[model samples]
Target: MISLEQKHHSLLQEAKRRTQPDIANLRLCFELLALTAAIDRDCAVRLAPHNLSEGKFVVLFLLHGQPHGLSPHELADRAGVTRPTITGLLDGLERDGFLARHSNLQDRRKVSIRLSEKGDATARTLFADHTQWIGTLFGGFSSEERIQFSALLQRVWRNTDAGKMASPAIAGET
Candidate 1:
């Protein structure tokens, strides 16, 4: 029996020939998607033994930048998550003793969050380890290739118009 990978390869080959309007850009999109998934999978594997997810890692990483602490609103904006999503992340972090939430002195309505001692150590270690891993992963690429890919990705990012587009699922509702 043909393996799943074989089947996927066949499908992509067929798609290249038969896709509607013969858009060549789909190949680039697929390549980008596969590259993205591989990077995400590798990162997830590296963080797995520590019981860390990308979201948690991002929170810790962001907290490290603002040692004085960040407000939930600030985190939401920076993390590109909804305020409620940040609340969920904070709840887990607080429960894990990775961070603490304190009432903001400047605004009674807002709360500030900062890493605990344990959180700081974990974040720092993970950041260093992951930085090394990232460097190793990209070591094969020459400086020119890296620069070209970065520019290409920036163009694709702008093409998405993500900042201006509404969530696809909710677009009709609004």
Candidate 2:
């Protein structure tokens, strides 16, 4: 079986033969996607022992410190997910005793989610370790290199905004 790097090189060579485009930019995009997949896999492995999906972890991390808690809609918005998705995550988290839902004092119909004691403890422990894990991912970089990389990544991120996307005709050209 071919390695990923070998496959990537083969794909790039085929692309170069078929199109008159910036092969270097296309290679960078491919590399970025591979990096993202690797990072995601690493995250899943790290969270597995704690029985937390990234979505569940996001909800718990968001609700960690606030005694007042946030509404389901608020969590969906903060998590950048749809209402149904957040509801599913909330269901699992609540079922597992990671969170509790309380009705609002004035509006009994409205519900807010708060971290349970177990959830709080888990979040605290995960936060510390997670921070270190994330930092370690960048440990190979010097401070200045990290700063420059962050700036470059921010520039790339800005271009990824939906409103900034090129139209289909132009996008298809390259």
Candidate 3:
């Protein structure tokens, strides 16, 4: 079987022949995608046994220290997801008895979310495990290297022009 790196090299070679693409940029992008996919896969595996999706786990993690809980909108913002997505996660969590929604005393329209007893326990365990897992990912790097790597990643993140690109949908797809 061809290794992933070898496959990427073959694909890049084909790309060069077909379009004469910028090899460095394309390789970097491919590497980033591969890294993201690996992290996502690992996270999914880790969360599976606990019956949590990454989004649900993230919500639980964010709610850990909030004594007064968070509004669904606030959770959405902090989680960097849309309100509807957060609502769906919230619905699932609530159904699973992992979280509680409380109405504000002064305003019936306002609802705050907090973890159920079970959620608190699960979050604590997951948080510690998550911290350890994250550390291990960067364990080979020195402190200075980690800082420099973080800075470089932030720079790459800020340099995106993707927001201006047109969607890849066919004209009649919508």
Candidate 4:
């Protein structure tokens, strides 16, 4: 039986030999990454005037969704980042008066991070403008196409996870 590494190498060679490297698959990956970067950069640019970074904006946005707040670990899990990274982002947000950390009443040892009024306002303003861009990006797809695309992407995610092809969290990000 051929080794997995050998099979992978063969597949790589086959991919390279293709005329356009499987247009649909290649374009899917390229477009997803490009779009993510573009969105991130645009958000960063908008946040810059307020002295906020992309990561910080993301943290604020996530927290804004759950006004009740989330623990650092929970926030990290939702944000697809390390706890330490979330910690730094939260630190910046807190320092800027965008959020506050409160000890969980049930578990004093656990800390919950909540957005301040300023953070709420910022999140609303940013997302309100961002939604226009999001709508434009997906406007070309019909409703049925959007549904089908989402289903197909979910199947791909499940297959990748079941096969242990990549981190499930990372797959979900795509």
Top candidate on TM-score is 2
Each candidate structure's TM-score, on Cα atoms with residue i matched to residue i, is 0.75, 0.82, 0.80, 0.62
lDDT of 1 by residue, 1-174 (tens): 212344446667787667555345755566566676778989999988767788888999999957789999899899999999999988988888889998877888878899999899999999999999989877999999988877776556656767237564533331
Among residues 3 or more apart in sequence or in different chains, the pairs in candidate 3 whose N, CA or C atoms overlap within 3 Å are none
The lDDT of each candidate is: 0.80, 0.86, 0.86, 0.78
**What order do candidates take by lDDT, descending?**
3, 2, 1, 4
Clashing pairs in 1: none
Model 2, 61-141: lDDT tens digits are: 999898989999999999999999999999999999999999988999999899999999999999888889998989889
Candidate with better lDDT, 1 vs 4: 1
Candidate 1 deviant stretches above 4 angstroms: 1-10, 13-25, 105-108, 155-174
lDDT of 3: 0.86
TM-score of 1: 0.75
Can you tell me which runs of candidate 4 are displaced by over 4 Å?
1-35, 65-67, 104-108, 148-174
Of candidates 4 and 1, the better by TM-score:
1
Error of 4 at 100 (Å): 1.3
The better candidate by TM-score, 1 or 2, is 2
Cα error of candidate 2 at position 31, Å: 1.1
Model 4: colliding residue pairs: none
